[model samples]
Target: MSSTKVIYALYNDDDVLMDAVKQTRKAHHHIEEVFTPFPVHGLDKAMGLAPTRLAICAFIYGCIGISVATWMMWNIMINDWPQDIGGKPSFSYLQNMPAFVPVMFEMTVFFAAHLMVITFYMRSRLWPFKKAENPDVRTTDDHFLMEVSVSGDEEAMIAFFKNTGAVEVKVIEKH
Candidate 1:
């Protein structure tokens, strides 16, 4: 398999990291990953990442949950059991819908949350309790880090990194 060389730069400032990403793109170097203590808005656009579709998926999943829960409830109470209880009309959903609202809401939230989390994890290449590929742990807590993949002219990439205010840079190798 073909692999690329990557360099990690750690910085304490989020602004500097944002600027660095813009500068790196300006220099036309390909950056592979960015680690930040917290989210920095607009970094995705700066990195040229396409807008995510997870929200759409979440919505669809929520709709599915609602439909299944509603259908199951109606089918069981009206078709399977076919029993009216406590002077309530079980055969008519419009009259008994207040009872199913809680379940429908719960199912919607359940499906949305679980499916959205799964979609996010898959999209981010993350799994439960997975060790990070990043070398520095501080980047997740208090530092911003950028990883750039270098090819052909590494010197130029190094210069570009340094010029963009990278506090520390370390080369990573593939075995």
Candidate 2:
């Protein structure tokens, strides 16, 4: 099941791509992915990358979408079909919480933007119309890719991507 393979390195300079991810993780070499359009500072702690809870699961799915939109507007306009308008009252959240604050801020930004985009596409295995495993198409147009997935010494990972300053290297399979 180790078929999805790639080995690419094309660097210009973000300090030589952060010293080639700290020398290919100190020559242990297991970097699976890295692509750069921006963000290259420290590169997720040199690709250890274990500090994402997805903003605490989008703040607990935005507090369960503001407690199910304030309990479905307190069970439909304060207990089913209640319409007391200007007189207020009818589950008057302290005499009108600014008209339920734009439906609880659009249900907490629609449950924290659709449950933080389905918890970042199920913590980034992605799904549904998933046709991208881009080892390189010049890594989305400018090239800063540094993907590696070697098994053993494939010529010591092609001489550690040309001694950690790879301007271009390629080994591809996982199409």
Candidate 3:
């Protein structure tokens, strides 16, 4: 089987990883991926990744949720089976809007949260029982790992990573 050579640079600190990322970008080296024990702030910006549109999607989902909640509540309370509770039989949605606020808020939050998770999973191509793609298991503990594809001289790339504060650098063939 054909395999591609890649350099795996390990860092003990997030700061070092960030600096390495910047240096790699400055050197015009493409970073295949970065694995960190936890979320590193501004890493995406440093990597020059575009802003995510998840917020926009969440807003749209919230709108749909509120609309559904409103229609359901109106149909049940005003149109289909008008309630005559507390001697308020106006059957007007606007007049009874305050009473539906709780349901609307709940539905909005539920839809936004659930749909956003689904969107993130689908966008990331994650699924149940999928094999892990992590190159190094240390990345899941206290270390950060950067995967850089080798384009030219492997030794030069290794030296570059070492100069960029990598605690350990190794070249591996990925199938």
What overall lDDT goes with each candidate model?
0.85, 0.81, 0.93
Candidate 3 lDDT over residue span 31-55, tens digit each: 9999999999999999989999999
**Given candidate 1, what's the lDDT at residue 98?**
91
Best by lDDT: 3
- The sequence of per-residue lDDT tens digits that candidate 2 reaches over residues 1-175 is 5566568888877788888888888877888878876777778988788877788888888889988888888778877877889888876555666788789879988999997987788878899999987656765666688888867867778787888888888787774
> Model 1 clash tally?
0
Query: Which RMSD does model 1 reach against the true structure?
Result: 1.9
Q: Which pairs of residues collide in model 1?
A: none
Model 1 regions lying over 4 Å from their true place: 1-3
Each candidate: RMSD: 1.9, 11.8, 1.1
TM-score leader: 3
Q: After superposition, how far is residue 168 of candidate 2 from its true place, in Å?
A: 22
Better of 2 and 3 by TM-score: 3
Instruction: Give the runs in model 3 whose Cα sits over 4 Å from its true position.
Output: none
lDDT minimum window of 10 residues, candidate 3: 82-91
